[model samples]
Target: MANVDQDSNLDGATEGSSNANAPLKRNSDDPGWNCGTLCDPLNKDAIKCKLCGFICKAGITRLKYHVSGLKGNGVAICKNASKEDKAVCVALLENPKEDKIAKRKREEEMRAEVEIEVEDNEFYAGSKKKRRSNLRPLDKFTNPINPEGPFLNMRQQNLLDALSKERTHSVHQFCARWMYESGVPFHSIDNDAFEKFVEAVGQYGRGYCPPSQYLLREPLLKEEVERTKGLLKKQEEESACNGCSVMIDGWTDRKRRSIMNFCVNSKEGTTFHSSIECSTDSHTGQFIFDYVDKCIEDVGAQNVIQVVTDNAANNLAAAKLLIEKRPNMFWTSCAAYTIDLMLEAIGKEGKFKEWIAKAKNLTIFIYAHHWTLALMRKFTKCKDIVRPGVTRFATTFLTLQSLMEKQEKLKTYVY
Candidate 1:
């Protein structure tokens, strides 16, 4: 219930002097987090977990993981951390429904205060009250400004039906609650104490409070549907100016799934359209063509002037097929990918290949050894070696370019 300074390195935890070696005090809400037996001999700038006896660098995040029973980054989770603390920590790691309901309740209270207030009439004028006739039609009260604003959309209706709620669900309130509960100010979610704060009010609040995930599922779905509808509507409006071109990009996810994403580019601006999990079938020329055809049809065949994809055999086949079918709308490979391929090919030639290998080795050497990596950062003004891009060839080209730029500074450090 108490506020703590957010500026200190330890967020809600108690801040000590600026001495880098000093361990931050366990945050007020964090129960039973301390170093204990079997702690290895180490300098002051290291953390020793009391429950699991794991030692690591002195950082608040590591301490939090230990106290919250989160095992990550080579640190073992504390076995002795309270199950209550662990439960709250896990709930906030994902979206929780009770938090959303609480947030909506808070917004409603605030909005009630801000809106036009009506007070009871103090006195009536000294005049005889006229008898009222029931001749006025209540239908005349219908709003002329936004006649359809009061009704829910088909998506919202479907959402309510899925949830099996007795009546129609609210629209505006659902969206506000979704964002608030989802933690729109993203950095706050990283706080170890955020879950504690939410649970405190949720458990102690007056009246019946719904603390179930089922309550949130409907609202989250409705919000997502509305969000997609708004984006597509915006795209439709923008594309009216000059239509749009589609670009298809493919990548293999960690699970070995082939994913294809299609984006629209126009004078108005580039916008993402959709993605498809294409791992199911053989993505031959025919497979890629079928997906591209669907996108063209969705965006309007005549409106799409061009389709861009990589220069793979299957993609080339797809382009040929598209050209044969719709001659007016062109399909071609991406120019940037072509140039990146060239840079990669050039780097692989005879002596240049050796130079690229040495550059990679130097990067690996510094990164593998923490002390050297630190020294390298200090020398190069805190910039890491230019990271490799998604493609292997392109990655080599970029890292080589980066090393060349820092050649003089690296040489001085080496000597």
Candidate 2:
């Protein structure tokens, strides 16, 4: 009997040992188990990474860190893990609790929707009619349904509630001040792209950083160029359908380099074709003719209806050459330039020449002295004496007109 009892005790001990050595069964939904396997049956914390084949002594969290390729977590990252797998692990690590809460909320909402739909179907199928309320239809005027507007989701409502008039005004003032300080054009705020950019920034919420200078100059610039090309292509197609006018103009930049701009104008709009630097080449008829011919070729000679240029001798010669080559297209002088020449001739007259010289001297003197300028502004109520125009000669006449209009104020200030 003692031998049989000893045998039963040994059998129970062996069964208990086997149970202790059994592998732990983890939750099937755990993402950590997908990337690793149990290294030891008894030790639940020990896991072998399938990616790098490294055995980690820590728990599932450490195994996730390894799969996520995160450093400084007392575990080596999985070198063999792909970017997609690493991203999954990183997202899980960052917002595990938030993800769970969101999932639960979504499930509850779906269940509620299904219940409401079922109830609606049953109510519609039933023979009984809906009960009439005690309140009259006219009573709705006093107690309106959603007087503010339609109902919004919780997140949208929160965002709208947070954006008060005062906060919006403050943000506007801050942006305006930055643009003013940076010398950005005031009209830039009116651009559709600027409005969209502001909308995008607002949508991103807080903790969003602006693009770096390198991105702005390189990638963003290239993207903008490509977009502009697409828009110009549409314009070019329209121009091809309805012939375009080729306009050429030359100007000296701040660096004293002569630049010739070629533009194509159609019923759609004007598109800048190209710019050629002519600092090395003389302003000869042959040079102008060659440049204009090249531009016409690029724009498709068949699409060009007319060539327009200033009334300069070289431009006239170039126009003649263009007419000879392309008899179909006409050559015309710029009306604005012709008017500017007439204004220049009038300014050079004896009577007007002296008057303009005196006016120019007076303006120079008043602008040169801060005290005089301030006094003039104080007397004129901040009105300026100079009036800019399209051309230099036109500007002179406009300035004279402005001075005449403020003559009484000037007299008062001078006294």
Candidate 3:
């Protein structure tokens, strides 16, 4: 390639003073052109070698073999050709096939790039002149060269439709895989915000980059907080108009810290008011009363129709205090909590307790041995004899019920 460039410069420099007989026009695309020139203006078969001034009667292909020191061609090797010139000729002769393949690949890549650019422009601009100018050779079949010609044939239209469907399926698979791998809930797909997000991305087209972690955590988080505040404000207004109940629930978190949740329920919906960690404070009647009173004040005393709490001794004491303080508003025990307490008391009875203990021992034995557990599952058709529930007492009852339902299967397994 360097030799070719040097030869080109030499030709340009000597063009003015050169003999009129020297070939004026050069085939720049051919590497053999750098090694020699055509002997006659009209005869391409005869090449005059620059190195040895040997006029080969054969074509440039034979001249290249001669200059490169390759024998057996109809021409003699150029004795005056230097080693560097021989190497250049050898490389050019040997690599034409590989060079042609590489050139074709580059051309295909360039065509693909042009097609994508044209598609993007067509999608956005939709101008006839622009589309005509940018249309690929293959596209000319579907897209009319003249405005009077018919649009895409049925075959081409179907092909385009299939491609669009494939594109949509690919996008869907990408989104589904991300959600599945990331452990995002399936029901989140039904969320209005998620649907809108997909639509927004489609509208924005190809270059839509998702929000970074910092944006999601900082600015987006702050925006969502403000939006939630607005919704809560509306809920508060409804609560005031319709009258709401203040419901208190106490539970321990995974860290074993005692936490109390305060919620306000109205016809509109239930809104979580606040939560407080009471691990450091004693859960006395006074503490409960103070917290409930503060919640009532926050919700507005007139809007609070009732204060509902679990039927625990401290909660009962707090109810009495609330009744005395707010005589107009009612104080009540949670009915669900009362039922749970009844279930707990019934489970502790002698007969029920003994049955529960035996059931627990059977479950423990089966679960302890993998073989026993697998046998039980096979007999039960993969249904376990233990059924958990939301509450401890409810879970016990549910498990007992499951045992009764699976009694035949359990007997078969045991035998």
Give the TM-score of each candidate.
0.48, 0.58, 0.58
The lowest-lDDT stretch of 10 consecutive residues in candidate 2 is 151-160
Model 1, 14-94: lDDT tens digits are 322332344444323333233432133234336566555566565535555555666654666767767876675455443
Q: Positional deviation of 127 in candidate 3, in angstroms?
A: 27
Instruction: Residues 277-392, candidate 3: write the lDDT tens digits.
Output: 99999999989999999988988999999988888899988888888998998888899988999999998999999998998898899989999989898987787878889898
Instruction: Report the C-alpha displacement of residue 226, candidate 2, in angstroms.
Output: 1.8
lDDT of 2: 0.77
* Collision count for each candidate, in order: 0, 0, 0
Task: Estimate, for each residue in 1-415, the C-alpha lDDT of model 2 and write its tens digit.
Answer: 9999999899878866875665443434677788887877578888888888898887888888999998898899888999998998998898976888997686445333432122322221123554322333333223222313432211111122243565445456667887999999999986656654554444432222467788889998999999999988877898789889999999999999999999999988898989989999999998999999999999999899999999899998888888889899989989999999999999999999999999999999999999989989998779899999989989999999999977856866875
Q: Relative to the unseen true structure, what is the C-alpha lDDT of residue 178 in candidate 1, on a scale of 0 to 100?
A: 64
What TM value does model 3 have? Answer: 0.58
Per-model RMSD to reference = 21.3, 36.8, 34.6
Q: What TM-score does prediction 2 earn?
A: 0.58
Local distance difference test, each candidate: 0.64, 0.77, 0.76
The residue ranges of model 2 lying beyond 4 angstroms of the native Cα positions read 1-163, 173-186
